[model samples]
Every structure is written in C-alpha cells, then in structure tokens.
Target: MPSIKRKVLVLIALLVVAFIAGIIFSPFLRETTYQLKNWVGKPSPLPPVSKTVILYFSTPKGELLSPVERKIPVKKEINDEIRMVIGELIKGPKTRSLFPTVPPETKIRAVYTKGDTIYVDFSPSIVKNHPGGTSGELITIYSIVNTLLENFPSYSKVQILVGGETINTLAGHIDIRGPFKKNPEMIEQSKILNR
Candidate 1:
C-alpha cells in the first residue's frame, strides 16, 4: 500500500546501497584499480649516474669475487671512476660482519682499474672458510657495490671473478655472472645490520 512517490524513493535508496556495496567488495573493480597503478611506466633513470656496476655469481661453496673495470669516460656519468670506489671501499674493514667468524688473514690486497673494468684481489683467507646464507651473501655483495658505486657513480655495470676467473655460483645457489645493477634495497638492510 505504499504511495507511488514512496515506492520510487525506496527503489532509489536500494540502488544507492547496492552501488556502495559494489564499490567496497567487487573483485573486478579492485583488479582494474591495481592494473592502472602498475601502468605508471619504467623506473626513472638515476640522477647522479653510476660509475661501475657489479656482477655477482654464486658457487656451491659460497665464494665471491669482483673483477672491476674502468671506462674511457665516453658516456660515463660520475667522474670519480671505479678505482676511487675500490680505494674507498677497501679502506674500510671490507667486512661488515657482526658474527666475528671471518678469519683475520682475509684481506683485500689491491684494487686495480683498466678501461671499464676494476679488479679487486683479496687475500686467500677470504674464501678459506666462510659460511654461506642469503643474508650473508647479499650483505657481502652489497658491501662492495654500495661502497664502489658511492665513489664512482658511473659505468653502470660490473663483472665479478675469483682470482681472475668468473665463477658461476655463490654457495651453489645464486647466479653471479652478467651485469648487476646496484641494489638500493640494501641501504636499509645495511643500516639495520650496522645497528
């Protein structure tokens, strides 16, 4: 027995409620929204530019090596070059370890640069008895890259080798060949580990 105007009002109210529910719970709407956000496009280029990029490979034994190269400064961004990064990075302890399991004889002997490659030679003790894990491996990897990239700021890629040979594996898990871009994600992890 509702009046015509009252029925029309009731119908409008039901439609509005249904629309609100769809907005809150519809899966199709959610998928469309996320897809739009991801369409934002590629990563913007680094402003400061980068000098050398490190390449990481994994061996079943968990050993790491970085064979660096210097560029001719053709289209390079930072002027410091990879040698500066090596000098600075090597000057530090080289190992940002909290466990104290690393051997004392383990040391980085020299950092050499030629053209677009930088070579870092370390004492044999470095790979002597080091244990391996994802955290440890990435920490070591980022330690070198973060230090070098901070100094050179150009190049854009790196190749890592052991005693002058590029190994294919880190702890028999990760592949460390080709070119590896510096990982910004490591910055936060470094801070946490430092503290």
Candidate 2:
C-alpha cells in the first residue's frame, strides 16, 4: 500500500511539471507552429503587398496621352498612393513608343491632398528642363491631371507647383496657377488600352 501511494505521488508530480512547462513554452510553441503552417503553404491574412495602377504618358506624337500600367507597392493612405503613382510617372514609360510628359530629371518635391484638390510640387527641373511649346506644355499638364483624376476618383482637381511655389505656367502656355481637372479631350480615344 505504501508503494502504491508513492507511485500516485510521482504521477501527480510529473503532471505538475508538464503543466508548468506548457505554461512557460506556450508562446514559443504557438509562434513556431504558425511559422510551420506558413512554410506548409498556409495563406496569410494580410492584404496584398502591391497593386497595379494606370498612369498616363504622352505618345511620341505629343498630341495625345495614353495609359501605361504600373505595379507599385500598396500604400495605406490615398495621398501616399498618389505620390507613388506620380513618382512612377516621373520615371517614364517602359514602352519605346510612349514618352514622358514630365521631364525625366524632374523630382517630386511633395504631394498632399486638401478637400477635393491634390497639390503636387516638383523640382525646378520641371520648368527649366521642359521643352517650352504650347503642345508640350499642354501634354505635360494634362498628363498629370488626367492620370490623377482617372486613377483616383476622389480627387476632382490637381494643382501643380514648381519648387514649392505656384507657377504661373508650365512653359508659357497653359495657366497652372489653379487646380486643373482631367481633360479627356487631350487623350487619344483610340489609344485608350488597359492592361
């Protein structure tokens, strides 16, 4: 009967040790288990890390603009997303037939949203390096306005600034002192292709 009592005590002690070990190791076990599950092809609950956006770039003819698809990292805020899209636009199009309206060397200084207007500021290169002409200025200005308004419906107008100051015009043609709306007429109807 004493031996039987000792065996029972040993079993209870083993159980108590196991309980304490489980308490100590539970978090580690859970983390490891989750990693293992992910390694085995379990999909994570997080949203997609990137998304596709359409950017408008001028065709080589400079008479009209066309859509160029770009894949960029997803941003939490709309303004940040717009900045990313604009940055991509500044990078120019991958297709040889298309040309960049904004100067290739132009840098995006800032982008912000207020009410229904989105203000985009560019470095002095935008104005200084731009090919000054009526058609050139129209293409550059409309390309930005159309790209922003088409992709982001929430914004109705876009205001352009050069080196943080409001520019009277981009190239002595179009008045850029105020916000501009999307001008679909500037876009080639036949060239509107989506990817």
Candidate 3:
C-alpha cells in the first residue's frame, strides 16, 4: 500500500511540473508547432531592403509627364533620399518612351526641408541648358514638383533654387518664385510603365 501511494504521489508531482511547463512555454511551443506544420510550403518572403522612388520624366512630345519607378538603397536621412531621387531625375529616363525633363548637365546643389516645403537647389546649368518654352518650362517645373511630392507625401510644396538662389521661373515661363504643389493633371495616368 505504501509503494502504491508513493507511485501515485510521484505521478501527481510529474503532472504538476508538466502543467507549469506548459503554462510557461505555451506561446513558444505553439509557434514552433505552427512552423513545423507549415514547413511543406514555401518560406515567408523577406521584407524589401530597398525602396522605390517614383521619377517623373516628360513624354516624347514633352507635353506631359510619365512616372518611372526606380529602386534605390534606403537612406537613413530624408534629405539624402531626396537627393538620390533628384540625382536619378538628372540621370534621365531609362525607357526610350519617356524623355528627360531636367537638363542632363544639371546638378543638384542642395536639398532642404522646412515645415511642409522642400527647397531644391540646382546648378546654373539647369537654367543655362534648359530648353525654354512655356511648355518646356511647365514640364520641367512640374517634373521636379511632382516627383518630390509623390515620393514623399509629407512635403506639400517644392521650391526650385538655381545657383543657390530662388528662381522666378525655370525657363522664364511658369512663376517659380514660390513653392509649387504637385500637379496631378500634368502626370499621364493612362499607363504606368516601369523599366
């Protein structure tokens, strides 16, 4: 009878230990079990390490803007990312269907952010090399404005600065004296083609 009681007590002690362990490790065990059961399928996809920046380039006719997405290394600073995007714009469109808006010779001088506005300073080549006409100027200005505003929606306005000073117009057409907002109508919504 004493041996029987000892066995019963031992079994109860083991059950108590198992219950405590289950309570302590239920979450971990549940996750491990789930992973094991789902192991037959493909592994979960990894998060994207790079980010896409939408760049606007003029269409062949230079009348409207077309957006092209370019993947770039994510930058810790917002200004650095903005500079990267502008640099891509200067590089021009990868697809032949789109034309460059910013002058190829142009260089980004600096990019600054204040409140909801972004100030982009460019080299004088932007003005000197610009193909100046009302439409040309409009495309150029809106290209910069739309690209910046679209990618970074936090910024509501963009001001273009040439040679480190605020410019009244990109090509003596549109008044660029103040910050410009995104012009959705200027962007071609018919299609989104990326290279």
Using TM-score as the measure, the top candidate is 2
Backbone-clash count (model 3): 0
- Write the residue-wise lDDT of candidate 1 on 101-144 in tens digits: 23345465555555554455555444554456765556555555
Please estimate how well model 3 matches the true structure, expressed as its whole-model Cα lDDT: 0.91
**TM-score, one value per model:** 0.43, 0.76, 0.75
lDDT of each: 0.49, 0.89, 0.91
Best by lDDT: 3
Residue 45 local lDDT, model 2: 95
User: TM-score for model 3?
Assistant: 0.75
Per model, state how many residue pairs clash.
27, 0, 0
Q: lDDT, candidate 3, residue 144?
A: 93
Note each model's CA RMSD in angstroms. Answer: 17.8, 7.2, 7.6
- Per-residue lDDT, model 2, residue 183, is 93
lDDT per residue (tens digit) for residues 1-195 in model 3: 999999999999999999999999999999999998888777789767799888999998989999888888888899999999999999999888889999999999899999999999999999999999999999999999999999999999998999899878877888888989999999988666675
Worst 10 residues of 3 by lDDT: 186-195
